[model samples]
Target: MATQDTSTSTQLSPEALEGALAPLTAALGDRLLTPPADGFAETAAVFLGGPERIPVAVARVRTTDEVAAVVAVARDANLPLAVRSGGHSFARHGLADGGLVLDMRLMDGIEIDADAGVGHAQGGVLAGTYSTAAGEHGLATGFGDTGTVGITGLALGGGIGYLSRLHGLTADNLLGAEVVLADGRVVQANADENPDLFWALRGGGGNFGVVTRLDLRLRELPVVTGGMVAWPAEPGTLATVLATLAEAPEKLSGMVNVMTAPPLPMLPAEVHGKPIVMALVCFAGPASEAEAVFAPLRALGTVFDGVSEIPYPEMFVAGGPEGGASADARPGFLGEGVWAPDEAWAAAAIEAVSSAQHGLAVVNLRPMGGAIAGVDPAATAFAHRDAAWMVTVQGMALGLDGVPALREWVASTSGTLGVAGRGYVNFMANATPQDVSDAYPEATLARLREVKRAYDPTNLFAANHNVAP
Candidate 1:
């Protein structure tokens, strides 16, 4: 528990603020930034469009000891502290309102041991960095869709990507982590050391401590058959896409998006700004079988087909679709098997997107359950193993004026299609206590709370989807 002498408010008095910031400034020099600093704006930016947050200060630390120093300062000051890695959090947990932030970007480092089939990644390492390093050794770890996302946050929230069906989740591949506890003590968590803390860290978010580094398990995957395949949106398009994915082997995984096609050079001019069903797929099996694996999708009348054998790292080179500067996203698990009357669901999604006048709206559906379901629910903090589809409805606009309508569209569409379950923590921004409760099962939440009690009883680390102690 935090000491009684520690101040519990983020807004410090002028004298208290000066006293609290002086030590960090003296120790870190220019690395410690206050408002109006040259790089403060860039360092404080959030990835997915959320309300802007101005942290009281930002510290760019290089080593684990430096991280501990920052944590200790924040602890003694009783100021809210947040960690920034890739800064891709939809909820923008990386930024603190009138609090301190540890900018871990300078800690980026990665070491690959091909012989041991493992990779050690610093908390600041991005998915692209780790994947590129591992790809050199014909190895890879399962991470989320985007390359710019910080690998640690993604892994902590149960990473799901093209390789998920083949290699389970990023959390499944986690072998160990080096963390700085709420009390400013540095420790290691793994199967044989601090086992309970390790279990909670796998999918419990950054509630217990500040993770400085991660030890990840890697698989030998030199290349894959992966790329985008799109077709004109139709009543039956979504069903065909999902049914094909369901029948696919574990080696194949894909994400389907129902949205208005943007004007890209590769796409026909006529298809631009028109509704379409686009599928981004990856097959990790034998390259020779790639064509056969994708034959069914081809039969659906593709307007564009870019699928082909390529180095696994190449898939992330271009990244995914562009998101609005400010966006609203709702992600949830689709239980009861792909929503009954697939055609109706598909039609509703298409209609919603087509009628949206303010901003871009998309209905995303990714098939779950292959190696993902093979893990028992009790094995980790992420409990949605039996789900068939991971669904998210999102909309983005230039300003706040267009937000209300987008929100209405998202809520209505989600209700119509039935996207109710423990929501995906990583995609949820501005989540409430009930949202946190809904993200975990009762037993899982209880166990997480126990770990929380043992590790962070006073809740010093409450920036994320907190599991209250």
Candidate 2:
């Protein structure tokens, strides 16, 4: 559905592109799609949508061989190739402007080895699908907060979620991977084989290759005490909730977001559009003690409470924003710890939200410790193990016209909150080279670059958070 802008000099020559796609056409047949195809838009619709999110061509592959074939064709043509799993790239990197896209959705498959407590999942598996499969066996793996997020992307970028403190990051659970390298060679990566690539694959963005399948470590998590609870976002309410969460036990992991209440059916109509502090928490310990662990937060006077013992997968489908909303956000790690907000900090944040009268604004804070910090910083590609919190300054507008103002508000709010240094790569959008530099330390980046050189020296996989050779 996305037509090339012929007027832009940056546009690829349509005739040349068509010629380059000939090999894939012969190989994939009807599985390959170009613009204006009946199902192209549906196949390319990722988390964020627009003309930019549409690629010149899409290849829907059902098997690893097909993926390798497509990758070989793309490399031979020297065409930029984007890979799509759950299609949630914050910067829309999953779709290429004038290149081919490898649609991995059809490859979705999960085989849970309950006896060994491991999950063998294809790269295309979504968080919810994997969780549901694992939940059947009283086992689970930590992905991000969203059900639709790709397990491969989340794990590769250091996934943090409700069970993060209990089970560690999703990357921490990754035991091995089947990667298709730049040269079209399919190889395995893990502690025992290709250890360097295996280390890079963990918490390293999609830089080295296209992962075909992953071996993830699962935890025993049949049911957890988890759900959303909220309080009116009065002045300093954000600060109080954050401080409380920071002091809570490691078994209790909370993701707190400050935003104006929407007109959801469960919420009282009177509170609609009013600022509120909402938190989604999970207690992995005894269900009976969930009440005690959350007592400190409940004492803050909750306006709504939905916390209860439930199936692990249920947490992903709980109340959330409607799909298709466009967000302008800045992600950062606050190594200094929770916001020790003064009166000024609270006022600035409140005003930032108020300015988005017709849109949506959110300040999300997730404290870090426990199993996440227990891992050595240099153990994997995710080096920010000592960070105290993960923060995102986000604003969602209804239309494109409101995005610019929202971006300004996000910048201003981020400055006020003092969000500095490297951020969680998964949350970064429209990141610059400087941003990439911030995401990794000098030693880690140097090592990653060396690996990039060894495997993908030509940089065939440059669409993701790139570590150039």
Candidate 3:
């Protein structure tokens, strides 16, 4: 168990607290949390894992008003407040040292308007929940590959998914957001209201304020043709597959993973331990049309081909890994589209990943283009608007003991694939202060700082991708 810091020099006075917290508790009843509550441990455990830190208290807000109240309390107390949606920050950005943690997981609620092609999801809602709810209406929004990621975090960081090529990034479809400023004021931000904050929230991470609700623009989507296609681990075959995919249609988006084949019923027993290029693809079109689009890949002589026509929601299920264990690796986003020569750095990165000593190291390449690139980089805080491929180097270890070696391998391997030295905030696992700085451009960073100053002058919300106020 993580221990909490009890030094009161930085804490609020009892008199100051009485005035700020009395009305909040009166409004919320028993929703607020102190150190010794039964829910404290569970609330603290919400963070994904890795770093250990404990907050002075946990605020279990159930509504926008409750969120505002908690913010007010933290502000009055001069306490560092961490806002947690899904608690999925790779760097443990949702946990504070000894301050207040406003756990927003309880606020999940999804409402879909099929006729209007829009969906309203609360800040705490997970991507899987929103995807499933919208799928019921034959509608969908672009989100990250993972279903457990929070809608707030992914949308804010410019969500990428199967629908990215056809539609756009998740932030591109954001209609509006209800945010609670540091001053405890709730305001709706959109194109017509507080537009600067709206722009900042699109890709600025959690630098502005705590988003209570999000109104997202939805697309008319029914069935999607998608699944995995696994090819043999031979060097020539892997090289050809990647080269072919580079010129593939923008309507089809997929992720190519070069790693050791897992022992599954679908895989041949002979090819289980050998290396393989597992391609997870999703084509946003009719089943018949999608088959034709995937013909080139099918002809690649894959050892196992699992491609099939499935509903859009099923795509989410296919990408989810079976077990839950902590893994260490470094993640970076190449700013210069996918223009690297096949014989140069790209092939070298693949070769290094395939030969890594880590149990199942992989250089996962995600195709990006089309609707995602159509959006202007300056239109939102997400600056990697024109990137053609998002690559992640993942190393999965069995236990925490292997973290050091795995981290070293991932770091050195990522250094070799270097393009711009920048990274996508969502995939960043071991982001340093410089890595965080590199995620945003100078102009965006300056504007974010100003916004942080205006909203959280004292830097109360300093636990996330922090920006100095």
Candidate 4:
């Protein structure tokens, strides 16, 4: 549980306020957002849904200098600060209770150096934006599945996506990062420059500093073949699919979703409200080659097959809901490698899906192998290099009253899958220290702690999956 400071009334000195706002307003011009400003509430509402928190101020910084100025003010005033890029954080960590909320959404800039095969993305760029820009140049970088996910948060937390099996985790492609330390000092971290900080930022989960920009290595990705295939959800189907997926070629990557079929126009009407397995897939090779690769899956008797040759940008379209008040979700990593499946695991998954009373219960299984598994576990802060799949159980009800029951059902169902200890940072709702520790090995945790001490000695950036300084 998070300890809250319950003192009702707290104030900052007038001089501190003047000192903080003066230079920030001057440097950012009209980007600074005070409580009374237009769009202040909307800016605060971007990344949050369950609880409403009104910050003292929301500073929409456009550049690194503005970020430094905002940090300096927060430091001088002794106020907690929240950093937000795309504002899609699952735990609402991007919104401060009563402190400053630093909005980085205005910094969406992408520069791709095709000759060098590298791309520089500003903090606010979403995964979709970056992918589209890179696709124009016949280049690509690994990012999370969702288009709305910020590059800053996803890269820092070990990005797993369709391309992960072919290229690598997003952190693995990270060449460098421009970060503003807790003390408002701007620094560049990479293999040769501030190497320790660079290692920690890879999978450290935004604890060391606020990343202003990222330099990512790009891959040659002009076109790829991928999409979703939906099948009737039966008792033994899930187990059979998992067993087959474990043996599929690493060139083909995908995710399996067990959920109540939505009333979408593309889905067959008979499948609505019925249990279904929607497997989102991606292949990095040519269309003909991909067709050959996916032929085995096509033989599985899917109700609807939308899989075909498509542009890489279409991959982000597979992600589900971004913001809503009536959803309860828990993202976790399964521990066991791709071993033989059992009836128990399949039974639990079916029961969870069948027992969903209110709205929908989904078991999302994302494939993990190829380049992601090839990287050494010690190379970056993302320690789960060997896990076979990342699973998330989500239930969305009609009202707030259903939140507890939904959350409880998700927890209980996840436990029955037999791999509940490891948790994914991006999917974490409101996790404890034990949950965070379980995500990484002992050695990785120790190194992360040392790096945290060096970058944020006072633990000022303690919002997301914090590594205590």
Q: Which model scores highest in TM-score?
A: 1
**Model 4 agreement with the true structure over 103-172: per-residue lDDT tens digits:** 8888899999999999999988999999999999888897877788899999999888878887888899
lDDT, each prediction? 0.83, 0.81, 0.75, 0.79
Using Cα atoms with residue i matched to residue i, what is each candidate's TM-score against the true structure? 0.95, 0.94, 0.89, 0.94
- Tens digit per residue, CA lDDT, model 2, 370-466: 7888899899999888877888887777776777777777777888777745877888765676677688988889889999999999988888877
The clash count of every prediction, one per candidate, is 1, 0, 1, 0
Candidate 4: lDDT of 393?
83
Taking every candidate in turn, the Cα RMSD to the unseen true structure, in Å, is 3.5, 3.2, 3.8, 2.4
Report the lDDT of model 1 for residue 21: 81
Model 3 TM-score, 2 decimals? 0.89
Write model 3 residue lDDT over 115-151, tens digit each, in one string.
8888999999998889999989888887877788888
Clash pairs, candidate 4, are none
Task: Report clash pairs, candidate 1.
Answer: 91-429
Better of 1 and 3 by lDDT: 1
The residue-level lDDT of candidate 4 at 121 comes to: 95
Tens-place lDDT digits, model 1, residues 82-118: 8889888766778888889988888899999999999
